[model samples]
Target chain A: AQSVTQPDARVTVSEGASLQLRCKYSYSGTPYLFWYVQYPRQGLQLLLKYYSGDPVVQGVNGFEAEFIKSNSSFHLRKASVHWSDSAVYFCAVSAYGNEKITFGAGTKLTIKP
Target chain B: GGIITQTPKFLIGQEGQKLTLKCQQNFNHDTMYWYRQDSGKGLRLIYYSITENDLQKGDLSEGYDASREKKSSFSLTVTSAQKNEMAVFLCASSIGRGTSQNTLYFGAGTRLSVL
Candidate 1:
């Protein structure tokens, strides 16, 4: 069975620091990768996605993720973080052309002001 | 912008009682899904619908029933609420399956508590 793993349970970074949240996926074929963020008491919001061609994908809120096929990793990143960037980040993977996504446990990001 | 709405922001029920949660999407998406989120666990799929009147069981569909009344609405019912059960029920929708282009959109979610 295909699965997604996010190793970190929580991460804390200063307001001006950079951020990286790791994600790894297990699948047989090419994977469709996605990053989603959930704010407190809010729904999950799409941050970015990677399908084909581009290994580097940009998302909303100045976030981007690089899909590294070799290591089965898709890590989310931001050049500089802000105070409002605190949220739980989830990494998801889908079988090629399948809509059913397997999500990671998620990493809670806390921005220290 | 389109929106997904889940009714009853918070639900409280007694053990063994039947409870239902409703979801509506204005995006006209062909697919809708229901998921459960525990305090520290990832979202678990419960049930889904490909279109109106079409239902599919997901990984965690046992003990739950789902209904797609129409293209714009879907409802999930707990067959029998269990005591000490507490989780967040989320409703989501997407245009189609296959590619990352069809991103899932979610509602605020309905928090359920059973005592």
Candidate 2:
């Protein structure tokens, strides 16, 4: 079985500061990682996904994540954050032939002004 | 671009009552999914359908029933609403069999409150 772990339950970052949210997964097979964001009262939207090729994948709104197979991690990063970035972010994992995806508990990000 | 719509944005039910939620997608995707989201728990898959009339149980399908009568619509039913079962139910669809590369598009979600 595959599982995702997000170390931080909540994170507060000052606007214009760099940010990083940690995520780790346990999967024996090749892992396809994804980052999803959910705004208040809205459905989750795909931020980025990684399957092959580049280790660093860029997503919408200047978000990016790096897939580190050696560490079994896919951490989301952003050079800067805005107040509008306050939302919950989830890290998910899936395999190439798997039917379902496993999601982390999620990290609630609060951008402080 | 397509959209997934989930009817009854909010539902309030009494304990032991049966509740149903509906989902519709215009993406013409081959797969549709239902997931339950709790406050701290990320998202748990309840049911999914590969095609019309095809139902598959997911990790959290024990207390739920699902029907996919048409390619564009899927519905979920709670056999018995638990008093503490206050959560959000989400509907999503993908272009294929939910492979590694297929992106899942989601609906806004239906919030359920069991009193």
Candidate 3:
């Protein structure tokens, strides 16, 4: 079975501090990973995705994620976060490009000013 | 640039009443999808269409009927609205439906409430 695990249901961080949202997946075949962000009263927006190339993929709003095959994880990170960055993040896994994706429970990030 | 538009931003229907939600995308994408998001439950796929006149069931398609009358429009119908049922129905379109990896463009979503 293929699945995504977002270990932390919620995380809090101070504004201007570094932040990391962990995500792990279990799939037998090669995995295609993606991170999406959803703001309150808004639709989901794609953050980034990882495929065959570089382990670290950069996304919009100065966000990036590193794909670790050995660890079965693709965690999202940002050097500094603002209050506006606080939102719900979802991690998804697929067989390959444009295939059916299984998503994690999602991690809610809270930034304290 | 393309946008996915969902009609009836807010809908309130009676129990056992059949409700319909409409979606239209101008991206010329091949696939369109309908997903339901509960208060705490993650998004659940309800129905998807790969192209014009093609309908595919997702993990949570029971009780829902979808239509792909044209390449740019897809609609979903609630067989029988349940009382006190509340959920947000999201519409998305992508180049393909086979992979989760495909970047999906979503609409603001329709907030549904059954009385």
Which candidate leads the pack in lDDT?
A: 2
- B12-108, model 1: which lDDT tens digit per residue? 9999999999999999898898989886678888887877898878788998999998999999999999999999999999986445357899999
- DockQ of each model against the real complex? 0.60, 0.67, 0.58
Model 2 lDDT per residue over A26-111, tens place: 99988999999999877899999999999999999999999999999999999999999999999998788665777898999999
Residues forming the 10-long window of minimal summed lDDT in candidate 3 chain B:
B94-103
User: What lDDT is reached at residue A22 by model 2?
Assistant: 98
Q: What tens digits encode model 2's per-residue C-alpha lDDT throughout B1-115?
A: 8999999899999999999999999999988899999988889889988889998788899999999999999999999999977999999988766575678899999999999
Chain A TM-score, structure 3: 0.96
* Best model per TM-score: 2
Candidate with better DockQ, 1 vs 2: 2
TM-scores of the candidates are 0.95, 0.96, 0.93
Model 2 regions lying over 4 Å from their true place: none
**Which structure is stronger by DockQ: 2 or 3?**
2
lDDT of 2 at A84: 93
In terms of DockQ, the best-performing candidate is 2
Give Cα distance to truth, residue B63, candidate 3, Å: 1.5
Worst 10 residues of 2 chain A by lDDT: A94-103
